[model samples]
Target chain A: MTKMTIPLGPQHPALKEPVNFSLVLEGEQITGSTVNLGYNHRGIEKAAESRTYLQDIYLLERVCGICSHSHTTCYLTCVEEIAKAEVPERAKAIRTIVAELERIHSHLLWLGIAGYEMGFETLFMYSWRDREQVLDCLELVSGNRVHYAMNTIGGVRRDITPEQKTEILRRVSILEERTKYYIKLGTEEATVLARTQNVGLLPHDVAMNLGTIGPTGRASGIKCDVRKHEPYLLYGKLDFKEITHDTNDVFGRLVVRVLELVESYKIIRQVLNYLPDGPIAVKVPAKIGPGEATNRYEAPRGEDIHYVKANGTDKPERVKVRAPTMANYVAVPYMLNSGYLADAPMTIAAIDPCMSCTDRAMVYDTKKNKVRIYGWDDLRKLGIEHYKKRGVDFSKL
Target chain B: MSEFEKEEKLKAQLEDKFGGAISDMIIQRKDRVWFEIKAEQLVELMNFMKTGMGFNRVSTITGVDEGEKLGAFYHLTDENGIVTVRAKTPRTDPHLPTITGVFPGAEPYERELADMFGIKIDGLKPGRRYPLPDDFPTDQYPLRKDWKVGDAYPEEKTSPATEAK
Candidate 1:
C-alpha cells in the first residue's frame, strides 16, 4: 500500500487551538508524524519585558485560560524570591486553594474533551456540567472564574472569608461525589476502555527520556511531580498523594486525571481547614533585583517552569515561560507513530494540550506567497468536501 | 541529609569532577543552585550531571542578552532540586554545542534559543524555525537587546483609519 501524508491542523475540528500535525499514514496506521507549531504565538515573553512586575501578573495570567493561576504563581515565585519578600502563611494557603481549584476545573475540562474525542458525548456533557461547580467555587474565592488574578508578588491577593470557606466546602463535597462517579464511569465504561486501553502507548523510559511531565508522565509511572519533588506554596504541608498509573496508555492518562481530581479536592480541603489569619499580601520595592531566579510549578497539565531576570528596575530584564504542553509536545510524535489515525485526536488530547500557553512568539503569514484566497463560504465548502472524502458528509447540516 | 547539605555534596562532586571548568558556583537556596561554565565545557558537564550526579531532566533552557555576550542557562532538575548551568557565547559569533545527545528534550529549547537570540546550536538538525514564521526575516532576532518590532517588517506604517482621523 502506498503511504499518504495528511495535515491534521493549523485549524481542524479536533483541535481547540491552532497546531498542525503531518501524519504519514500507511492505510489506517500512522507510520510517521511531525508536529508544526507557532500558529498562535503571541510574543507574551517579549511583551513581558516592557511590563512592571505587578503589571506582568495580569499579563502572565492570560497565558492560559485554564492554568492562569499556575503561570502567575510560577512567575511571582521567581519575582518574590529575587525581591526577597516573605509571604504570609495565610496567603500561601489561599494561593494553594486557588491553585488546586484551578487544577480541579482544568482536569474536569480535560475529562470532557477526552470523552468528546472518544465519541462518548454523555461523559463529556456530564463532566463539563460538574466542572461548573469548581468554576463557581473559584469565583466565590477570587471574584473571577478563569484568570483568578489571585496571586500577588509577595503572596495572594484575596483571603477566603469564613462564609466563603463554608460554601467552598459544601461545593467541594458535591465535586468529590461527582469525581467519584467519574472514576467509576471512566474505568468501567466499555467504550472508554475499548478506545483508550492500548492506544497511545508511552512507556516509562520513553516518558522520562522525553522529559514529559504532569499527569501525562505520571500515567507512565515517571513519579515526578513538582509538588511532591519540590513542594512550593502550601503543598509541603498539604495531605495528598502523587497519583500514578503503570498502564502508560490513554486509559492510564484518563485514570490518572480522574484520580488527581480527588487529590485536588483533598488539597483544597486541607488548605481551607488550615487557613491562617494574616495579611494576604506584603509590599516589596518595585525594583526587584540584578539577580535571576527560576521557579517550577505543577500546573493541572504538568510542570510549568518560569525564569525571570531582573536588572535592578521595575521591569524585568528577561522572562522565559515553559508551559507544560511544550514539554509534553516532544512526546506527541513518538506516541502518534504506530497508532491508528482515528486515535490521533484522543492521544493528542491526552496531553491536555494548551497551544496558546505553549506558543510564545511570531505569527506565520498563511497568505504571504499564495495567490488564492478562500472566503468564508469557500472555506466552509472546502471543509465539507474534505470531510466527504473521509466518509463524513456535512452538506445537509 | 538535609536538602541544602545534599546540594552542597552535589556541588562538591561537580567541583571535584570538573574543577577549573566550572566557575561562579553558588547555592541559590535550599533547592536551587547556580553556576557558570564556558560554552566549550557544557556538553561534558551535562553528561556528567546526567549520568554521574543523576540530574535526569533538562527543565528548560533560557537565553539571555547580556550586551556584549549571549548567555544560555540550562536548568537541569532532579528529584532533589534544580542546578542551573550558565554558558556564555560571544555576541559577534554566538555558537554553543548541542546537548541534545544527552537530553533529547533540549532540541526544542535549542531551536528556541536559535530563534529568539540567534545563538546557533552547532549540531542542531536543520528543521523549520520554531515559534517563528517561515517568512520571518533571517537577520531579525526578537529577543536580542537591539531588536525592535519594526526590524521584522520595516515598511509598516500607521493604520489607514488612524491616518484618516
Candidate 2:
C-alpha cells in the first residue's frame, strides 16, 4: 500500500485560521502527521517590546479575535502585579463579569464551529444565534463586542451599572435556556454521537504528557483549570464549580464546554450580585518600579499565561505569552492520526485552535538570494492562478 | 499543613536537589515562585523539577534579552503550585539546552525562543520558523533590547510580529 500525504490548511475553508497539517494517509487512516504553523505570526511578543504597556494591552487583545478579553485581563493582571497597584473591589467584580461573558460567547462560537465540522449546519446556526446574546450583554457592559477594551492598567475601564446588571441577567437567562437545548442535542442526538463519541480520544496520560489546558485537560480528568489552580481575579471570591468529564474524547470536550457555559452563567450572576462599591481603577504610576511577574487566566480555551519584566521604564523589557492553543496543538496528531478521514475536522476543531495566537511563518527565497514575504493579497493571487491553471475562469470568481 | 508550607516543601525539595545551582529563591506571589540559576543548570533543573518534585506542566518557556545578558525563564507548575526558574546566558552566541527531552512540552516555546530572541536551544529539532516569517532576516534577533524595529538590518521596514498582531 502506498502512503499518501493529505495537506490541510495554511488556508482551508474548514480551519478558522492559517495552520498547515500534512497527514500521511494510508487508505484513509492517517499513519503519521506533521503540523506547519506560523502562517499567522504577527510578532506580538516582538511587537510588545516596542509598544508602551498601555498600547500593548490593546495589541494583545487582537491576538485572538475570539478571546480578546482573556488576553487583556491576563496582561493587565501581570502588569498590575509588577506595579503593585491594587485594582478596586468593584473593578475585580466587573472584570469577572466581562471575562465570563467572553467565555460564553467564545464557547458558543466553538460549539457552532464544531457543529459545522459535524455537518450539522442547524446546530451551527443555533449555537451562533445564542452566541449573539452573550455578545449583546458584553456590549451593554463594555460598549464593544469583540475587542472590548474593558481592561486597563490598574483595573477595568468601565463599571457595570445597576440597569446594565439587570439587563445582562435578563439576556443571560434566555441564553442559559437555549444552552440547555443545545447540550441535549449535543449528547442525545444520534448524528452528533456518531461523529463525536469515542473519537479524538485523549486518555489522562496523553493529556498530561501533552500539557493540554482548559476544558480539553478537564475533559481528560486532569483538574488543570488555572482559575481553580491560581485563583486570579475574582475567581478566588466567585463561587463556581470546575467542570470536568471522564469521557476522554471529542464527546468529553463538548460535554465540558457545554456544562461550563452553565457555570459561567452562575459566575456572572454571582459577580453582579456581590458587586461592591468602589472605584474601578486606581492611578498606576507612569513608570513601574523594576519588577517581574507572571499572570495566568483561564481563557475559554484553556490557561493563558503572560510573563512581563519591567526595567522601571514605560515599555516592558520583555513580554512572553503562551496561549492555550500552543499547549493544545501537540495533541492534534494524537487526536487526528489513525482516525477515519472524516473525523479530522471535528478532531481539529475540538481543540478550538486559534492560529492567529499560535503561528509565525517566514518563507526562504533561495533563488533570489533573499527571503520573500507573502501577504494576504499575494496568497489570494496565488490561489486565483492555481484555480485558473485548473482551467477555471477566476475573472468570474 | 499550610499553603506556604506546602510551597516550602516543594522549594526545599528543589533546594536540596539543586543547592547552589539556583543562585537565589524568590517567591514572587502566593502561588508564583521564582528561582535564578545559570543557563547550564537549566535543562538538568527542569528534568529534576519534573522527575523529582512531580512538577509536570510548564506554564511557558520565556526568553528575555536584558541589555547585558540574555535569559530564559521556565515557569513550571502542577496540582501542587507554580515554580519559575530564571537562567541567564551570555549575549554573544546565546544558547540554552532544550528541556523538550525532559518536559517534551517545552518544544514549541523553545522554538519561539530560538526565533525571537535568537537563543539557540542546543538540541531542538528542525522545524518551520516560529511566530516569525521564514524570510525574516536571519541574524537580527527581534526581542533583544538593541534590536529595535529598524536597528540592525533595514532590509524592509516591517517586522515579524507586526503581522504578529
Candidate 3:
C-alpha cells in the first residue's frame, strides 16, 4: 500500500502550540515525517528593544506561562552577568526557593498534560489536583497564578514572610510525600508502562547529535544540562543529582521527570534551611554600561538560552531567546518515524510545546471590556455585521 | 588537567589546526576561546574539535547581523567545556555551505539561522521551511539590523469585512 500523509496541526487538540506534523504512514506505523512551525509569531526580540530594562522583567516573565520564572531568571542572569552584579546570599536563597517552586509547578503541569495525552483522566485529575498546592504556594510568594512577576534584575521582587516560609515548607513536605507515591505508581503501574515503555525511543547517539536537552536529553543517556554544567543561580552551591534515565524511551523520560520532581522538592527544603534575612532587591543603576552576556538555564522542557546586549540604557539594545522546545521540536520527525500510529499522540505530547514562550504577545478587549471569546457562529455574525458597517463588496476583506 | 594548562593546550591545538584563525582568547568570565574564521574553514574546525579535541556537543548556533556583515557562532562543548567558533559572511551575498552533513544535529540550527538571517545554504534543499510564515517576504530577513522589526510586522487590525467573512 502507498504511504498516506496525515497533517496534524498548525492547530490540533494534541498540541498546545501551533506546529504542523506531516506524517507519512504505512497503515498504522509512521514511515517518515516533517514538523513545521511559525504560528503565534510575536516579534518579542524586536519588542524588547523598545522597552526599558526594568520594564522587560515583567515583559520577559510572560514568555511561558509554565516556564515564566525560567524566562525571567534567564534574562535576569544575563543582565546580572553584564552588570557584574552579585546577588546577596539571602537574595540567592529566595531566588532558589522561587525557582524550585516554579520547577515543581511546571513538572506537575507536564505530568497532568502527559496523563491527559494517555487518555488517563483519573491520573490527569489527580495530577492537576496535586499541582494546585504548588500554585497556592507560588501565589503565597509571588501573588500571581500564571505569570509570577517576582524576579528583578539584581534580585527578586517579593520576600517570603516567616508564616509563608512555614507554609511553604509544610506544603513542600506534603508534595514530597505525594510525589513519591505518584512516582511509584508511574513506574510500576501497568497502564503507564504499556503506553510509555519502549515508545518514542531516542538512542544516545541520536540524542547527542540532535542536541536535545532537559529530561528529553537525559532520557536518552545524554548528560547535557545547563544547570549542572554552566551552574546558574544557587545550582552550583546546592546539592542535587542531575537526574537521568538510561532507557531512552517514553517511559524513561517519564521516570526522569518523576525523579526530578522529588529532587526539586529536596532542593526547596534545603533552600528554606539556608534562608537569610536581607532586602529582596537592590537599586539598579539607571544607566547600565554597554556590555553583552549570555545566560543559559535548564528549563523544565530543556536548555533555555538568552543573549542580552545592553547599551547603557534603560531598554536593551537587543535580546534573543532560544526556547528549548524549538530545539527538541527538531527531533520529533526522527522520533515519530520510529513509532506506531497508536503511539503518535503520546510521543507528540512528550515534547511540551509553548509557542508563547518562544515569543510574546498581549491582547486587550477594549470594546467588550472583557476578554474576547470567539465561537464559530459569533465569528460568522461578526463578519456579517462588519460587511454591513463597511457598506462595501463582500468578496474583499 | 589544570584549567590554565587545559586552556593553553586547547588554544595551542586549535592554533596548530587552523593557523591565525583563532583570536582574543580570553581565559576568564564567560570562559570560551572566542575566534573568527573563514566560512569554508568552519566545518573543518568543527570536525577537528569534535573528533580531535573532544568537543562533541553543539551547545548552540547563534546568528548576528552587523550592518554589511552577518556573523554566525557555533558553540560546542565537550566533557571538558566550551569552544566557540565564530564565522561571518557579507550581508548582501549571504551564503554558507551546509554543516548538517557532518553534524546531523546542526540541521535545525542551520535552518533557523538561514530563515532568520536570510543566509542562504548552498546545498540545502530549497523547500524546507521551518519557522517563517508561508506569506513572509522572501528577501526580508528578521534579524538583520537594517530590517526594522517595526516594519516587519504590520500593526494587526481586524477589518470589518475580514470579521464578517
C-alpha TM-score for every candidate = 0.90, 0.89, 0.88
lDDT of 2 by residue, A1-397 (tens): 8999888887888677688899899997888888777887767887787788888998999988878989988888889988989889888888888888988988898898888999999999999888878877877887666778998899888878899999998998999899899889989999899899989888998888778888888999999887876787788777889888999999999999999999999998888899989899999986775898887889999999898889898888788888899899887888887787778878989988863222123599888888877654577787789888999867665
RMSD versus native structure for model 2: 8.7
Best by lDDT: 1
Error of 3 at A316 (Å): 2.6
Runs in model 2 lying further than 4 Å from the true structure: A355-397, B1-3, B151-165
Clashing residue pairs in candidate 3, if any? A53-A314, A383-B163, A383-B164, A384-B164
lDDT of each: 0.89, 0.83, 0.78
In CAPRI terms, where does candidate 1 land? acceptable
Q: Which candidate model has the greater TM-score, 2 or 3?
A: 2
Stretches of candidate 3 exceeding 4 Å from the true structure: A355-397, B1-3, B28-30, B79-81, B149-165
Q: What is the lDDT of residue B120 in candidate 3?
A: 87
RMSD of each: 8.6, 8.7, 8.6
Total backbone collisions, model 1? 0
| Shift in Å, residue B41, candidate 2 | 3.2
How do the residues A1-397 of candidate 1 rate in per-residue lDDT, one tens digit apiece? 9999999998899877688999999999999999887777888888788878888998899989889999999999999889999989888888888888989989999999999999999999999899889888987888677778898788887778899999999999999998889989999989999999989999999988889999999999998888998999888877899899999999999999999988888888888888988898898898889888999999999999999999998999999999999989899999999999999999999999863222122345677944564544677898899999999999999
